[model samples]
Target chain A: MSPESEEMMWCHSCREEYDALDAGTCKECYEEASETEEELKREIEDLKSKVHFLRLSSPIESDLSPSDVSLHASSDRKGVYPPVPAHKIVLMSRSPVFRAMLGGEMEESRSGVIKIEDVSYNVLCSFVQYMYTADTLLNEQLACELLILAEKYQVKHLKFFCERFMTSRISNDNAVTNFAFAHRYNSKNLLESSLALILDNISTLTQREDYKDLVEKDPRLVVEIYEAYLSRQVNTAASVKELQNV
Target chain B: MSPESEEMMWCHSCREEYDALDAGTCKECYEEASETEEELKREIEDLKSKVHFLRLSSPIESDLSPSDVSLHASSDRKGVYPPVPAHKIVLMSRSPVFRAMLGGEMEESRSGVIKIEDVSYNVLCSFVQYMYTADTLLNEQLACELLILAEKYQVKHLKFFCERFMTSRISNDNAVTNFAFAHRYNSKNLLESSLALILDNISTLTQREDYKDLVEKDPRLVVEIYEAYLSRQVNTAASVKELQNV
Candidate 1:
């Protein structure tokens, strides 16, 4: 309850939400989450060490080409490949205690020669880094970059951050609306957070000039919010009428 | 490219499609875009000054009850009126940006008072602001909120943001895969952008984990991207296999 207390914590596995409570993993999925964390951490650390060693190797062999490492060709050697991305960054970043056990600096272990020209590769690296660490102060610019990276690699953790980072910045109305679009397909937990914001501010949100633009893109949000307040079964015709007034 | 170059503007309105150049609102829509921007700016500014002059006295005067404002009579005034949330910081901080454009704070506005808690009010206010302004940031958040809010109020922008922002984030492989979905759903420009991303980065993105996610979300993206590359030839099955191999 202190002002200096940490903000934002929760286990996606259990969907039990909390902000800054530190018992470490949620009680329900603690072992499963912990086991997964350890395995992935080991893998990430191993990967990072390889990458760092690769980078530290003098003359940084810039020779590896995308054309050379053809995934279609069975014989395309995997030794000097591009960077990797994963879905468990935010999940991994959840427990500082867990991360410390894994041996830090995950990006330091990667063992490939992924080109920066390949945006996907860079995104993967970023996700790996994000896995080991994340903080409020990380650059918004980097956050934006990592989001694109997350989406590119299909890294759910990075993608989650894309959503979470954006959510944390919801100090203004514009951000709320924009995020609504960005994380549209985000599964249940994220959807609920967004709903809380919109449902609670109906009158104010409804009256804005560009509100029509929002409506045009998605009339469903209006319908849903209307549904929230309607404790009684809403006749479709009357529902539409009430919505018109609301 | 020079970092000082102002010419390299990343116009969201224009560069809609991944490979396709920026072109969301057409050149013709420029007049409207400019007009809307100016009008919104002026309106918001005017409103802020008005609220400042009006100064509705109490930070927490008699709570504005949503039920009292409604035409329908209610016995349970408290049931109709939800207690305000503690984080309701909107009117208090008095964001100059909000004060200027929103005409009046939520309670002070024409709809009379609907007692939403502060954080919710701020969130809703942002959504409304986003709808009118087409502010990218707000829209993004609103898109996420729409799923929740849309289920309640029949608000369109929230849903619009949720869907459109996701579509708008399209670029490279993500766009390529997404456009394939967009094309399936009849999202024209979105399809265009997705195709562009795929077309441009098919070599790599086709091999991304999202490629698999896209396929899972809709096999159409896989087929359509194929069709896009090999238009109308109907050799999509072979191309799909090739992509699978990639």
Candidate 2:
């Protein structure tokens, strides 16, 4: 086709539409643009996917979940959303006793304090790493705030460093007990995912020596876990195949 | 064998040991106890298997993940998990923004200042459901606390209830970010397990439209996610295999 008679195409990268005359350079550019656009779309999707996985992977992934309808009901009746600056939110998180309980897996019961930095693998390391180099040590909330900031800015390395560090110590009891609350808060999905990951550990514990002790200590739970396990689960084809192998 | 010297088998339900213990009601409590104890071992194994399943299923089912290091470094600081909390993590997740984002299937941009929840679907949900239905709510953290209390008190229902609630929402991002800190603070295995799960998600995004976008947005990330995917991923086998037309 003659250049004069050929159609034009738009070049997003160049920000100017050009002629597609004979599959015009414009078309070439648009295809290139499409490749670019397609690439951007893919990146956003990928980042989202990563976030999803990270949320599930966190030890206390159930942070976003809420309290029960009745407990919140009286409060909800007064207002739909809780007040901002979330006084109770922060205060509730600050309980040293709760923290002790939370860290009970490693720490002895409510007899001690559990620093936020101490819990996360990365943040603890970061705090320790930066303690010498940096002037100030980050407090628990500050650490969480920093993590939120890192996430917002797409500071991936920071997120990993922080998240992996913190989630490193999420407990099965923690994952299980907090399940509802995690879903209630702003971070339900991540919490759930993490719990799922931990379930295997808990499941294995059902038969392990440590868990055997746990069962001997709390046979009732072992029984309940068994009932619940039998209720909702369907055998995986892989598992069924494994069964056949056995 | 003669009836006078038959082997005694224990009965599970009645706690009686019978001779070659065929299934039967035993008036002898000691015999029944012996029978029940023997069967308990097998039941414990079954419970362990269930718990194991509970753990693995979430990370596998969640739709999110983390990003690569080098490529994501530019837009990010080479270390940050994504910022936007998974809608599922938010409080009253039935809120408008979530409805819109999830309904629209727009994973890129989150709208409004969404509220966070404190719920979960991990192993604890089932048990927690039975306990504390009114006035008192088991927030995610509280739920975790409750699970611990349950564990301490031998309240198996509460523990598993929390776990199930937690595992259900593992796909959303917000929970992961928030809880990682809590988890890491309390446990180590939970952190590593979470890291592995997030890593798996990162791998899944590659070679798809989302990963392609990462490449376009930041060419450097291309190398990262790709590398991560290649390292951990074996194959993406479909759960249901298609039959070929002959």
- Give the runs in model 2 whose Cα sits over 4 Å from its true position: A1-125, A128-205, A216-224, A234-246, B1-246
Could you tell me which 10 consecutive residues in candidate 2 chain B have the lowest summed lDDT?
B64-73
Instruction: Give the alpha carbon lDDT tens digit for every residue of A68-143 in model 2.
Output: 1111112233344331111111112223333234334544223223233213333433322221112124543544
Q: What TM-scores does chain A show, candidate by candidate in order?
A: 0.38, 0.26
* Index of the highest-DockQ prediction: 2
List runs of model 1 lying over 4 Å from the truth.
A1-145, A148-152, A175-179, A229-246, B1-246
TM-score (0 to 1) for chain B of model 1: 0.36
CAPRI-style grade of the A/B interface in model 2: incorrect
lDDT of each: 0.42, 0.36
Tens digits of lDDT, candidate 1, A125-202: 444444323212345656666665555445454456466666666533653454355545443444556556655665
DockQ of each: 0.01, 0.01
Residue B33 of model 2 has an lDDT of 34
Over B10-76, each residue of candidate 2 has an lDDT whose tens digit, in order, gives 3343334433213222223324334544565444544333222112111112322111110011223
